[model samples]
Target: MPTLLTRQRWQLLTCLALLLALAAGIGLRAPTPPDEPRFVLAARAMVETGQWLLPHRGSELYAEKPPVFMWIQAATYQVIGNWNLAFLLPSLLAGLATLWLSWDLARRLWNRRIAWWAMLALASCLQFGLMAKRAQIDMVLVALTTLSLWALLRHLLERPNTRLLWVAGFAAGLGTVTKGVGFLPLLVLLPWALWRWKVQLRPGAALPRARSLLWLIPAFLLGTAVWLGPLGIALLNDPSPELQGYARELLFKQTGTRYANAWHHVQPAWYYLQVIATLWLPGSLLLPALLPGWWRRLRRGDSRYWLLLGWALLVLLFFTASPGKREVYIFPMLPALCVAAAPLLPGLLRRPGPRWLLLAYVLVLGAAALGIGAQLLGDGAWAHAQLARRGMPETLLPVLGAWLLGFGIVVLLLAAWLRQRRAGMLAVLTAVLLWNLHGWGLMPALGPYSSSSALMQQVGERIGPSAELGALAWREQNLLQADRPVTDFGFKRPWDEQWHDAGPWLAQAPHNRWLLVLEQAISPCVDRAQAVMIGSANRNRWWLVPGTAWNAACHAELSKDAAAGVDDGD
Candidate 1:
């Protein structure tokens, strides 16, 4: 047993533990709202329509993002033949790759011990764990960004290896194609130049020539060309205004305009400071101790810390400058921070202060979980109200409460057994346990309500097989989970326009045709007495409208709104 705990064995065990934690709840739930369903719907369309170059949502082209992530999903689905598993696999694989890259980079920069610490720190981060388990593009983008950073660091610090330089360029290019910010890793050049000017180089170490760096342009271009090249040709060859509009929107508006003046999710400059404190928690709790030490190193002109910390700061500043902000935008910088902090974690963990903090954090988390669980089980009014508001069945309250109680009890007991002496280990254990319970128990329980699967299922049952369904102001989840074919008025089109189109469709076959209309989207012309209320999902009430519910008088109103270009809602 002692022999089994060898260094190699421990590393393997760490990886296996990470995998198990990340893979816990996959396939148990369908894709939920905000972003998951949209991506999956696009991927499914790709597989079904054989239209790999462009992604379509219902009838409209989805130009908000590049097709690379969708392509990965489509490819994964083709091989596995399971949408649930396939949609999530890319993020999982990207997460594992990210962990491996962080481990390897730390080992190369410092040693095996530090590598272990880096991987563990990154894995234990709440944001990292959250992104890893979801089918999101940010995780994949993080993986690519980390890969570019890893290669760039090696090339700049270790040796002037051209191949590594090309690797860095290509990865960033791929990162750009994945999402526009892929070129962020190249920002390291500024710090690298500053370090060269400020610090003395070790014997036989020298910076690469200016000309050698030029290779990055082509490499990066090659990466973007993977998606852009095809898109450009398609746009040029086909004179269709829709494709041209998609190209223009994707190339310019989505990338630059959105960043410069974000129309949604706007936040103040200091918002990320709050995000870094909370979302990056447990790991972020160490910052108070780590920052001073890092500053000391920077003051002494330590090039390693300069490069890693400097690049991370630049990435933060870059995102902070943007009007549009999201926590995941800075996720790529996490690996670099973990690597820089890894060598110091072992020392920090030995100190009593960090240990007590970790212990306290664990206790608070466990207590919160326990308290929330007890509240639900005791028929707390707040708990029941929350459940009802989310469209979750009241029957699930006991089961959810039991699961939370079990998690809390186990976590609290483990913290007690480990005490402060092994609080660092306790922290990792707590994270694993929390994620496992979330994935295996909590997420699956929330699946029906969260994914709108229950709502769609109920819609199917009420309408019967013969009824044709059309949707007004429909979400991606509604279309994805529908039992049969669904006709959706354009997703981005105005609610009035959608109502204009849906009214006539419902009027076509009043007896057999039904319309699933959003409560807000249902115009005053529709008769509420005839429309049946469908349960809420995704925070919106839906109504099943028969042809009898449609007032033909409303058509004149809808036409006037459409002709006037009066956009009521998105």
Candidate 2:
């Protein structure tokens, strides 16, 4: 077995390597997450109006979420002045920060071996890597949740310090601001309190002293009051009928009741299982083998391990119970699950005679890389030939080839390294992190959403500064801003308001030359001339130059599509 310093040295190296991998992923391309455009547009609206509390875009009420995400977006935009990178930078930082916290937590609980494995597992995972680079609230939630968990676990293991509890409270509060009230401080604290209560009942166990509970009151007040208070006062002072409908639909019904009612019933419980299988990929397979050992440790009175276990379960359950489910929901749970599974790697590689576990991982990942690489290569070659004919540099070919070859090389190296006991463990962790950073972190930002920047510039060239623009979907509103338009369509959660309401407002305004943005799926139904397809990230979005009587044309086209059985793949 590797000594503590030896393991620490390796872990430190792995951390640095993973950081580079993630950095490469971050730097190679600038792609904003899907929601980033919406948030950026809303932040711009804030900057324009000097109304921080009431987020808006033109006539639309843009308060689907609390302002924390928008605030981050606004800050990024304020500094970088580039919408895509600004929106992505915060989430990227959050992802990296979460990885660091996972290492710290792992060190506290088990040892350097487990910590390194856990961080590697997390950094390599498609789930975590992808979400961390996304322009969503999930990364922030993951970081804050991990910080809260680390603080709570630290308090539980050694002493019940009030300062740690306060920090935990602050983290929980911030986590609540990031996502909602479900996962962070609430589900997290409840389990710890109950477990601690049980410990107090034990004969010789020292109950958590009275001082430990003291932080809860201030944390509760400070966390809840800061955001909710201002929102309430703003609503009370100048209550718009628009905000009323929005508040009911977004803050309350959509997030709360819609789940039980099957509103956005995305998938069954098995949906997440499938997502976990693919998203977690090779390392995900090891979880079943690793859980037993960690479970036994927790059961045997290791409170730190217990806390981590509880953290993973609570995050998993939070998403599972939510009515709307998606693959990204499992992202925050990755760090904890990875750490818990880390300890088993050393034994699994050596004891299994090295043929089964490692070979299986390499073979599976290798096949997957080959399949994906083949498609990318064909596309790149065709693109390169076309670019050469057009007398361009055709630079993208080498970059594409390098990525594909790098992925293959990492897979091969990990397989060979795993054959030796010492090298096997190190290679697995290191390779997983590098591959994940490349595959998820680098690819999505570079490939899918990166095209948005070009689209923004192209649209900016065509549109005049005075033209009023509206987005059919709230998401592409940032694209309009990126195009340097003075006024934009509103940000609404359901996004139905723009196609339904904002279209008419822009047409009626003095600004007649209007650019309306719509997703490609919605384009055929938008009966507007001068519509151009921008780019395909997760989905395709478009900007439309609406004619006079735009709303009527839009509705007529939509009705025609409805009759023709054309849906937005709804």
Candidate 3:
């Protein structure tokens, strides 16, 4: 086996390179739809409008989540003025924290070699690496959850550090604001309860100190108060129905309505079980092969395995049991999974069959990349037709070409590692670095239709950046794309053949000149002769309406609000 110092410099260099790549393109891609725009817009609102306590999406109260993640993003954006950097820093840092937590946990459970191997294995995890750079809640949540576990596990191993027990709960509490699932750390108590009920710890069993659980509550509540206190003061001082409703939506509805009766991303109970294969990647392949080894460890009375496995399994079961499932929901458990699985890697890789198998697995992965490139950049009419059927853009050809080259190089690198079997772990880390490049570099082209950032910049230039804009409906991407504040003209219904209906909603404005941006497809059917055809981006068609007649009745209400000294709610 390679000692702790074997190829240490190369390992450090590769890990550092991967970190740079992971943190490379925070602001590169347009903020994606469904979740990102809302989060991005909320952070932008906080920075621009100074509503740090309350997060607003466009002109409406956004309480889908608490403001911890948004607060960090907003703080970053405020200093640097780069939206991508602001939006993505939390995930990147959280990913780093999770990796360190994994390394420490491995070192505690086994040794330094296992700890180093664990960190590398974790960095290469397909899901963990992706979330690390995304403008999403999962990565932060995972980090906090992992940190909490690591702290508590440290306390268990070294009873002198009782302070870590409280730290665990506090991280969980902060996690709660990051996402509803922030309370995952509190779940650690379940296993302790189980152990207490069934098994008696020997004198030096390194179990949890009994009194430590008491300190966790205050720390958790204190973490929550960071957001809750400010939010309360803001809402209490200036009460509004939207703000009130948002509070309920976040605290309860997001948990209850979204949990029991989720409106979006409702997947099967077995959904996570199916996605686990993709999430763990090469490590996942070794999982099945390592089962006997894991079972042996468990049987040998090493209670640490039980603790780690129990924590990960409980998280998996908790999310899987929920009706609302996303692939990302299971990500928090991955760090623990890596640590738990780290011990088996040294044994498996020392064998010839496992090394050859890993090589073959990577070979298949490379061939898959080549095939994707062929379909994307090649003159395969059948592939073009297939992609066209799925509504992909022809512009993706070049993007795919770049990804193909990157993957091809990674394949060659993996082959070299295969030839030099001692560098097996290097191959995996390098593969992850390549994967990061593909995801971060080529993401813009992957989903062309969703984000309108590039197109919206052009619109902003033509209409003047300060001009306030509004969307006809609730496609929230406009808020992120627009340079100015975008009022949501909550649509009565989507624009259709009778598209004139959207005119009133689209035309309503606090600003005099109304720049109604619509899909190019809708413009042809919507009679644009009366409006000035100002500009168009790839697929977004823009028109300027002179009269502020969008939603005329809303205009009457606005007049009343002005007379009553009531500023409009956004």
TM-score of each: 0.96, 0.78, 0.84
| Top-down lDDT ranking | 1, 3, 2
lDDT for each residue of candidate 2 in 352-451, tens digit (9 for 90 to 100): 5443654666656655665555655566556565444433333555555556656766666666665444534544454555556464543653453343
On TM-score, the candidate that comes out on top is 1
- Residue 118 lDDT (model 3): 86
State which candidate has the highest lDDT: 1
* Model 1: pairs clashing at backbone N, Cα or C within 3 Å: none
lDDT of 3 by residue, 1-570 (tens): 367566787768866876776776566676775567778878887877777887776656666678788888888887888776677777788888888889988998889889988888888777877788677888888888998888877776556375786788788888887888888867766765665566666776655557766788898888778778777886888788877887887888877778778767789888987788877776776777777887887666466776777778898888887788888888878888788888888878888777776776667667777677666667778757654554455676767666776676677566765553854665565556565665565675654455756556655676575565555433466657777765554432333312344445455543454546443323332334545555433334556543343434432221222222311111
The weakest ten consecutive residues by lDDT in model 2 span: 561-570
Model 3, residue pairs in steric clash: 59-570, 60-570, 175-182, 176-182, 504-550, 504-551, 508-550
For residue 319, model 1's alpha carbon misses the true position, in angstroms, by 0.7
Q: Candidate 3, residue 171: CA error in Å?
A: 0.6
List CA RMSD, all candidates.
2.3, 5.4, 5.9
